[model samples]
Target: MRSVSIKELLTGKQLLQEITVNGWVRTFRSNRFIALNDGSTLHNIQCVVDFEKFDDAILKHVNTGAALKITGTLVESQGKGQSVEIQVRDIFVHGGADPEVYPIQPKKHSLEFLREKAHLRVRTNTFSAVMRVRSALAFAIHQYFRDNGFYYFHAPIITGSDAEGAGEMFRVTTLDEKNPPLKEDGTVDFKEDFFGKETNLTVSGQLEAEAYAMALGKVYTFGPTFRAENSNTSRHLAEFWMIEPEMAFYDLDANMDLAEDFIKYVIRYVLDHCEEDLKFLETRLLDEEKTKPQAERSEMALIEKLKFITDNNFKRVTYTEAIEILRNSSPNKKKKFQYLIDEWGADLQSEHERYLVEKHFKCPVILFDYPAKIKAFYMRLNEDGKTVRAMDILFPGIGEIVGGSQREERLDVLKQKMAALDIPEEELWWYLDLRKFGTAVHSGFGLGFERLVLFATGMGNIRDVIPFPRTPQNAEF
Candidate 1:
């Protein structure tokens, strides 16, 4: 007999064949049937054991959370939920999880309790399904880029320059903590540090990706990005994954088109491949929403929300138009908006983005032409002078799912912008060199990988979607 995966044995065409399988026991009922799962599928295989034939010692060891290797003949199940099961011929205990001490019992536990047990949470159905969908989404991302003529570029995790221009970063150093090098001005001298200068975890891979995009025509970086922002909200993470794709010779319009198409394609891929997992998450979300107020409940279920992305075209609206809509809308007029939009040039918040997507547009909305002062220094200056060619794709719950802009390729203009922002030219000399040598119309966007996984899994907390969440005062796992 050959060892077979539970996933295959559940759906495969090998009936009545004796097979060997290794898995953890999910549940043992009536001292005769064993629920076995090998992390291969969400569903468990019911191994019907002949209690009379089995030794009492072996039967006593078959308990929930125990790791077992079983030789069984695959046969059609008489159970309602599953189509197939295993008729156990033999059982061997590889490991045994004590029922009294094993934390993960076969029951519905709160996400909070599960998060505390992050190390062993995957044994649960919810997290396993989420992780499975996450894996599929990641694979789909690479596949999409590869099929679209994009090269994968790995950006350095430790960077000398702050790409986001936000000073928050986890300083990387190998200097003495109490007494080491000190500048004459009473500041810690970074000049004598490991890198011979100050360095921190990268906030983004876009700048490096831009360099490769100028040469390779299209490139993408999917890696962990760090931020030291002290946010304890459900959406914030100190460390998270980012998918930033840069394309040379692509204007803002083309960038938006690519983003919409790419998001839809990946979502559709997951919907097609992870039907069982997605269905479970959908039911989970429905149960979760049942406790919330009617007004606050989700208008669509989990899979319905995923289908919403693939079935409908994203609505494109300018920042100016979005501002006008928000200003005239009931939320602003009734003073319901926490941050009122009374004037132009005000940075739009999550509420504003959601209003436009969920309330105003009732679909995904692409908002473009943001004010220059509110955007980054690299975005191309529009002809109107007050705006840059920046665009943000907003989803129903996620305020900004994607942010991109046509980069300012003009060497003189880029230098002027850098000078105004007080960003040292030497710090990014290589970046400036791109503009000098072969700069072209290029654009890219950074999509938080956790955010995508969260949205796809209908998960409310960003921490739950990511395997090991790095947050303020929390890095236990």
Candidate 2:
């Protein structure tokens, strides 16, 4: 009477039962057999329909990629290959798709070719599994925060200042581009704009989330952020989601605890809830080196890792120690890095981060107290005078999955740092007022949501995990 999903049916041992299924035909073999998928999982259910029982007109309309509603009696497959098969009795064609026009067919298609038809890419098994895993991870994030007694704050998408203090931001406005407002000195008059000043898409929600945390004690913001940088790398995205959690009266150790626990919670949740999808990924989607047998790579392994992180302690190392390790490493000589790591002041690149996490620690590593010059001005300055209170969480596959820091609570120190960095004083007046009135020690971190999804799904590129990814030189679908 009711429709059943292929995913649910595959897990059960019942056979020779009546069932109804509705989905687009993935592939058709001869005139009597068809493969149907409802985008629930990678595996499609095979339906055997007798051509002689159906009208010739109905047979002609039942083409590959056409939407169908079929009522059938499920029977255990006599052959040793499949577990079960459906013997169709009635077929209803909801929509017909021409075989010559459908982008996806039974044959395999390259990831590059699929990217071109991103709107229709979800129909594929790999993309479908990826989307399901991505959804599960997002739910896990919310569940973790809610269960941990953290208030979810919706940070503004358009802001007056870059939270990261990085100069990469997309302008958001209704002002005419052609006849723009100009000042006496030929500078664009931002006063005439919508916000009465230069406004851009927020790069991070940590700063705003801190405002709420200071009042509410703990808060997190999960929303889409924009970056207008032209770097065309597998890691960078023009538009991506950021998960920022800010906590008041929290030190560096407490912040690290939240980071480690949150990450583990998300990974464990996805693996537990999306078991079928994870099995598909492990066997089919991931690279051969990373793939493992479903039984060997038990969901408990993921759960155990998460429990270990939550119960045990994490490995913590200072920036100075990280640089020392990099300087003495052999990869430094072989690989030509974008930024050289000769001394303690150099910014750590992806290669250095990866080396520290994968080769040196062999686990998730938290590197803190970065040099002041390389980090944001808002970070609390350490007693060393050369380094600031910043932390980056690096994983085995993805380099820097999370970036966060303790805020500069002192008004005087913040003002001095802003002056030295040539940041506009008026723009940060509201932020400064927060410190002047009553500012407690606050800390927060920004987790790249897509990067986390990439780590969870074992998807190599950042684009593959996100639906309709917006990257430099590419914005298909």
Q: Which one is best on lDDT?
A: 1
lDDT of every predicted structure (CA atoms): 0.92, 0.83
Clashes per model (N, Cα, C within 3 A)? 0, 0
Q: Over the stretch 1-477, how does candidate 1's per-residue lDDT look in tens digits?
A: 667889998885889888999999999999888999988889898899989999998887788889999998889988887788889888999988889888999998899999999998898999999999999999999999999999999999999999989899999999999997998989999999999999999999999999999989999999999999999999999999999999999999999999999999999999999999999999989989899999888888888888889999999999999888999999999999999999988999999998998888899999999999998988999889889999999988778888889989998988988999999899999999999897789999989999999999999999999888999999997
Tens digit per residue, CA lDDT, model 2, 181-273:
899999899899988989999998877887889899999999999999998877889999999999999887788888988887887787678
lDDT at position 432, candidate 1: 94
- The RMSD of every model to the true structure, in order and in angstroms, is 1.1, 3.9
| Predicted model with the maximum TM-score | 1
Model 1 TM-score (2 dp):
0.98
Estimated TM-score for each candidate? 0.98, 0.92
Model 2, residue pairs in steric clash: none
Question: Cα lDDT for residue 407, model 2?
Answer: 88
